[model samples]
Target: MKFISWNVNGLRAVVKKDFAEIFQKLDADFFCIQETKMQEGQLKLDLPGYRQYFNYAERKGYSGTAIFAKDEPLTVSYGIQAPEFDHEGRAITLEYPNFYLVTSYVPNSGAKLKRLDFRMGWDKAFHAYLNQLDSHKPVILCGDLNVAHHEIDLKNPQSNHHNAGFTDEERQSFTKLLDQGFMDTFRHFYPDKEDIYSWWSYRFHSRDRNAGWRIDYFVTSKRLADHISDSKILTDIFGSDHCPVELLTNTL
Candidate 1:
């Protein structure tokens, strides 16, 4: 089946920027988006043949996540059950017969690492949550994880070394997740590929120069790695600062 994930940045804004066309063309079995930035009834999507699930942040026009899937899930949950983090509407988990699909908008460390402490707490909690899910069945997780796991994942690692997404703590948290048996699908396919990114800064003509970071991802349980058919970054499509990442897999 084909699963696509994009950090649309803002759903309402993207709807006017060829989102409908892209949506129709992709025709994915499962389409997930992060940073939706809207609550229910604010907007409606005419996605034919897809059941939609949305988790809206308590705060207005802030962090949120949603999923539109051609097949109905056996169960749908809004968050990982952490009340503290749930208020932000940053997560959604859909349980299918074979696996659990989770889309998340991981908290950013913020400027000057202002929120690094909170981000770390979230990483720890989220790590345990994923492990719990993996204990039951393989998990397919995707979204703007908000961190560039390695120097290769971003364009200017040296300068961004102390930046929010590239901070040592943030990268290590991602490493901890991977060590816990989650496979980053894109890296699995293109281990040495460079200059390919999913999120770009609006400033500095970043997109024009391809000065972007691959902070978004499609990750699955290590056991499902063999079923991964393709993992790609569709960096050309633009509506938001972030582009779409795709995963074609046999497991789900």
Candidate 2:
């Protein structure tokens, strides 16, 4: 099975910019999206073979998520089960016979870390939510997690150490989440691969210089490691600031 996750920034905007072509070309079994930035009834997509599931934010044109899967899930769920944090439509989960697939658009810490407290709270709740799901079955987690887990994850780590995504608090929270029996699939496959990233800043020609951060990811339960064939950053394909991250696995 193949899984792809991309933070399109805004689904409506991306549809106008080669998204249809790219979506048809990739043809993933499961395609997860983050930051859809649209509410209900805003846009309708014509995807024939895929079942579309969306969790739209209460606030229009803000944070949201969606999943398009070729196979119908046994059950579908939205949010992380925490009322305070569920308003943003930040997550969606699909249950299959073998495992649960979850995609999330984690909240950013914000400029000057104004939202760091809320982000920290979210990290805690989200991790608990994943662990609860993991107890039932292994999890295939993906989307723009919004943190560069290690120094190797970003281009200018030294300069951005205290930035929202690179902060010690955020990194440590991610580490703690992984420590609870999850695997960061890309780093698991390429521990030493360098200068590869999924997201770039629009300013300062960041994408052209390859000045970016590997914030998007495909994470799975530690036990699913053997089932995964490869995890990759699809840097060449572009319709948004963040590229798609992929996971290929043997049939579970």
Candidate 3:
């Protein structure tokens, strides 16, 4: 099966950018999106052969997530474990026959690190939530996790040391997640690859220079490591500052 994840940045805006055409071409069995930045009734996608699910933020024009799958899931859930965190609509999980597919647009720590404490609290709760899911079945977690897990995951790591997303504390939270039994499928295959990234800064021609952060990911439970046939970062696709990341697996 094939799965694709993209932080569209704004679903309404990307529709005009022909995101639908690219989505048709990718033809993933399952597709997930983040940072939709819109609420219900603002936009609609008529994707045939797919059951669509969306979780919109309580506030208008803000963080949100959605999932489209050819096969309907047994159950679908929105947001995280905490009611307070659920207000922003940053997550969605689809419970399928064999596994749970989770797509998230993790809260950013903010430019001044003002939100760092909140984000750290989120990481702890999020990890615990994933662990609970792992106990039931394998998990395919994908989307803009909002953290560059290591120096290898980004360019100019030294310069970004104190940056919100690249800060040591955020990176260590990601490490703790992996240490708890999740595998970052992309790095598992292309550990040495560099300068390849998903989210680029809107300033200074960052995308053109490839000065970006690898905040997007396709991760799975360690037990499903061997099932990851391929993981890809589609740098060519354009719409948002972020591009799509894909995962292909026969076991899905």
Clashes of each: 0, 0, 0
lDDT, candidates in the order shown: 0.93, 0.96, 0.93
Cα-based TM-score, every candidate: 0.98, 0.99, 0.98
Cα-lDDT of candidate 2: 0.96
TM-score, predicted candidate 2 vs. hidden true structure: 0.99
- Model 3, which residues run further than 4 Å from truth? none
lDDT of 1 by residue, 1-252 (tens): 899999999999999889999999888999999999998899988988999999999999999999999998899999888888889999999998889999999999888889999999899889999999999999999999999998999999998999999998899889989999998899998999999999999999999999999999999999998889999999778899999999998745
In candidate 1, position 147 carries an lDDT of 94
Clashing residue pairs in candidate 1 are none
Sum up the clashes in candidate 2: 0
| Candidate 3 lDDT over residue span 51-149, tens digit each | 999999999999999999999899999887788688999899999888999999999999789999999988998999999999999999999999998
Worst 10 residues of 3 by lDDT: 77-86
| Over 4 Å off, model 2 | none
Best by lDDT: 2
